[model samples]
Target: MKREVRIMNYFPGCDPTEIRMSGNYRYYLSKKGERPLIVIGMNPSLANRKRADLTVRKISKVAMLSGFDGWVMLNVHPIYSTNPKAVKPTVNNKKQLRKNLNFIREHLNKFPDAPVFVAWGKNDGVYILDTGRKMVNDLLKEMGRECYAFKLNKDNTPAHPSRLPYKIMIDAATNMNCIYKLQGS
Candidate 1:
């Protein structure tokens, strides 16, 4: 049996302009605002311009409650996949990775003051995810921008927001004290 995916209007005031996508890749998703909480995640999921997956909603909620007018979600891997294990890098995907990294740099340059939250989990030992995360970390270090997270896992990976408790998430978001500076600064 095949399951159907439903796309709904989770953001009442958001129009299609808030999302940016290219085929299976999502560069970023945002709500209307001058100040947006920028998030870097493992990959895109079911969320898109027209829908709000659980993860997207969680990130947006944390952003909203943290005094940001809106949120912008980017990802280490640009491809949309509910299961990380299913994502593998092909030649085309490698191209996508370069493009994805370029867009990330552009976004960071675009929003110099926006708080960046690195929320990609351990990536379940996926090489591409690990590489992507490391590349982004290098970029962060190069840009000299401080990043934050709810907490780090036992493995020291940034805690993915989905696993974090709502109250903790809000506290971390509001306090903005869980700073995790990349090593080799």
Candidate 2:
């Protein structure tokens, strides 16, 4: 029997619009042969209105084309709040973070051995590290699977702007068989 892969999609904060503008909205991982579980962020950005329709259309296409199991929207609850001073508010809230992890656990209970957990980050790069760390722990505890977080470079290579930190993350993930694949613009 073929193993079913499920993706839990994660986006920073509560912005439906940001979710739409993200590269994953256009180039879905399922198209690359990986299963995706979409977890959308709650924060809305200025460009959301412009990209909302297109993003929805693309997501719809991916859903039809890839047959996603389902999606969970994080940062949507009223109680979820973030620190403005922090670069990424999503990581700052421990309560919401646990909720997100629970969401992942619920999904993993149904589908086993999925390769990746797709998450979208803010342009500022604030949420990536926290999100990556949480994902790693969540995956290990729930499924014994390792997780990786990759940020794409301008050339679409798996490179981080901060080379040293990126290298450290890559090495760590690699050692655990988790890799963040960077895509170029």
Q: Largest lDDT belongs to which candidate?
A: 1
After aligning candidate 1 to the native by TM-score, how far in Å is the CA of 135 from where it should be? 1.2
By TM-score, who's the top model here? 1
**Per-residue lDDT tens digits of candidate 2, residues 66-133?**
34433322222112123212334444343444554555465455445543423334334445334533
TM-score of each: 0.89, 0.37
User: All models: lDDT?
Assistant: 0.81, 0.34
lDDT of 2: 0.34
Name the regions of candidate 2 deviating beyond 4 angstroms.
1-57, 67-92, 113-117, 122-142, 146-185
True-vs-predicted CA distance for residue 39, candidate 2, Å: 5.4
Model 2 / residue 136 / CA error / Å: 5.4
Assess candidate 1 and give its lDDT. 0.81
